[model samples]
Target: MGFTSAWSISAHEDAFITELVPCLGPLIEAEETEPGARERWERWQTSGVDDDLVHLVTGGGHVQRLYRGLTDDDPFCVMDDVWGQEGVEERLFFSAFSKDWAVRGLFQAVGPARAALLPGWCGNFVLTSAEVRDTLPRIEEALSCGPLEKADADRRSGLDYLPDEESVLDGPLRMWRLAAQARIGLCGVSLVLD
Candidate 1:
């Protein structure tokens, strides 16, 4: 099984509840109106509602844990499941772009040429709004240049690297656009790996 990566939009708990939740409530309600959605909606509402809220806004997978308590001084233990850790809770999980695609396709296509970008080495990290804003232009430029070439390994494995066909860049591009929007709104962009 491969790891999936997504851009998560997060903010302090007060901001999330007051600012972002209202914006998403209508959308979540509308989605629930669709057939076969009631079960998922009820499940989300009853158990792990915060995670449900995150899934609702960013359109990503379940986020069992969100915040790190103030007393947790260790930066490496940011995801501890302590009771007070859920305070800074305005987080939203977004797209699930594969790690393989990020390293082999997107980074290779847009980063400096010949750079050995390794997906496995990229653990979860946060991207500030400013960082997201700065990177958007480069990614957009790369996308505008046209479809990217597949990794050499994919090519060697007899996979067709068609420029006109769908490539690995599609998912990340969509996620980046969303991240850019969140960045413009002054939200923190975190890259979560699963």
Candidate 2:
């Protein structure tokens, strides 16, 4: 599995499905849904609605990394090990919850508004833009303190999975890249389950 990201143009997921995903289209030559689709596509292309999302797309696959040596252990918990911050493992989401619910939960669960959500990180959590912004500094601080590999290695022998090579794909670095891109994209990283 991997991850993809975008700028948070909306509290819901409209920009992701409509704006950012379409930016991947080849120069905006809209496709035909049926026999008469091309004409409709062309009309929309020249409709003078400015494509506002082109500039927000970040280059590179930030969350695109193989799960080489990861365990079921929470990465945010690993962050806690480095940052000494508590309750992070609960704050993250990886599932397809309703946008309003997820966004509200994240906002409430991460900051001064956060409460006893009572064991979060259930069913594939996702973070919205505000949540990402709230948690990013802690990530940055944790990265500065130490590598996640160190903390993770203690739990399981993830190092054994490594080949005798130097240029291995680092999970922590990939996380940083994802967070950075999400910050710029005004969105949070969405894990792409394989």
Candidate 3:
């Protein structure tokens, strides 16, 4: 596994997300060409009626921190925390999901000092080397489970629909995450620690 340098990125103000739609239009159209693609996307738009998903990702590991703040002030700037917004941190095996938007994230331990500063840090796990090995199969199982097999079930299931290509993989710095894909319009950060 390889480790990449840590960095931060932010969503736009107002929407709390950078509108990558225009840039992502081509990719969305491509997904439309995949098997049952359009139906899957529509289903995703409606899935997750009541559950706030606590997805997990475990691979080597990467430390990525994101925050929601005044886009006007930071304007695409990245920060260390949720920036007064709600978020969570935990140790996890690398994982990704396909519900509202294909999401791939990581889990890492927060230092005593930084944990005090970051929000969304309850009930998260700290990963161990052995735990990492144990978690890989689980992560693979989660990703290989298949696309949203039922209508509206995806929404109710608390995850966006994902195609096989969206599987998370080991990246630089032992980091495992979903490669940037079209269906993943909603973006969030997963922070992991060594």
Clashing pairs for model 2 are: 7-185, 8-186, 93-125, 93-126, 94-124, 94-125, 94-126, 95-124, 95-125
lDDT of 1 by residue, 46-122 (tens): 55343333333233311212332223462222243211247433233233354332233333343322222211111
Candidate 3 local lDDT, 120-183, one digit each (tens): 2211222223333444454343323234432222333343324542222222112212211111
Best by lDDT: 1
- Computed on alpha carbons, the lDDT of every model, listed in order, comes to 0.37, 0.27, 0.27
Residue 169 of model 1: what lDDT?
47
Q: Model 1 reaches what TM-score against the true structure?
A: 0.32
Off by over 4 Å in 1: 1-102, 105-124, 142-144, 147-167, 184-194
Using TM-score as the measure, the top candidate is: 1
> What's model 1's overall lDDT?
0.37
| TM per candidate | 0.32, 0.25, 0.23
lDDT of 1 at 192: 42
Kindly give the stretch of ten consecutive residues in candidate 3 with the minimal lDDT sum. 176-185
Deviation in Å, model 2, residue 184 alpha carbon: 5.8
- Candidate 2 residues lying further than 4 Å off, grouped into runs, are 1-14, 17-123, 141-159, 164-173, 181-194
Q: What TM-score number comes out for model 3?
A: 0.23
